[model samples]
Target: MNAEPTTPTTRATDEHLLSIDALAAWIGVSPHTVRKWVTRGPATGLVPRMLRINGQIRFRPDDVRVWLDTKEIQ
Candidate 1:
């Protein structure tokens, strides 16, 4: 079995809207790293569409799933 974050998994609607901190927790990385990835572009070709609310970055849960599915093989 693949140990990658991209491995197929089920998503709960409640966990869909992932903040940068939430995303980092899911991916086992630091929030800073997640922010860097969001800015520098994902290791894969998928880029998260960021929303600025009160000057804070947020990511949609569905979008993250799509991004994971579309990741390019290294």
Candidate 2:
């Protein structure tokens, strides 16, 4: 069976880029914490995988999902 091919529009819609507040809400943290996570160093091991777009910070939903998966403690 042939699956429907994905389009740019569909992919763009599916990959939501979140704001600091939105990401914080999704992860149960405060906006300040999220800001710290993004701005802090590698030592924290809590830096978010984000993009700097036009001087604004943006976080892809997929990146956040992957980060969360990596953080799972055994």
Candidate 3:
């Protein structure tokens, strides 16, 4: 009999990549908001930077941190 692995083989560092839902939760917003931000793209100048790999939107931890830092009140 053959068995399938339940867990993925991704590296721990790869976990820092944020999906729309994960980013939304981390940023205290809904997934729809994340999608909207992505849809708006850089035109609005209000969205965090993201990486597009194979057309998938993925937010890097560093980019998210920088964006948040820029938006924070001094």
Candidate 4:
């Protein structure tokens, strides 16, 4: 399936911010798993840079990519 393009926010265009749902889709995982990474990964170091709009969390797509790239597979 083709992916939907995200409209880059002013602060994140250069950093690649994506919604949690979008990141999960890109990584082939459930959104819950993505959230787990945010809370558990020793190296994730994710902070509040993600903007919350309408009660939903927005994450940097590049951050997600970086996290996945650096994760140690068990």
What TM-score would each prediction reach against the true structure? 0.60, 0.73, 0.71, 0.46
lDDT of 2: 0.81
Q: List lDDT for all candidates, in order.
A: 0.72, 0.81, 0.81, 0.65
In model 3, pairs of residues that clash are none
**Per-residue CA lDDT of candidate 1, range 8-52, in tens?**
487446654568998888767788888777777655453566667
Of candidates 4 and 3, the better by lDDT: 3
lDDT string, candidate 3, 1-74, tens digits? 65976776874565467888888998898999889888988557566788888888888887788888988887
TM-score of 2: 0.73
The C-alpha local distance difference test score for the whole of candidate 4 amounts to 0.65
Please give the clash total of every predicted structure, in order. Answer: 1, 0, 0, 4
Model 3 residue 61 lDDT score = 84
Instruction: Give the TM-score (vs. native) of candidate 3.
Output: 0.71
Q: Which pairs of residues collide in model 2?
A: none
Candidate number of the best TM-score = 2
Ranking by lDDT: 2, 3, 1, 4
Question: Local error of candidate 2 at 35, Å?
Answer: 0.8
**Root-mean-square deviation of each candidate, in angstroms?**
12.4, 4.7, 8.0, 10.7
Error of 1 at 31 (Å): 1.1
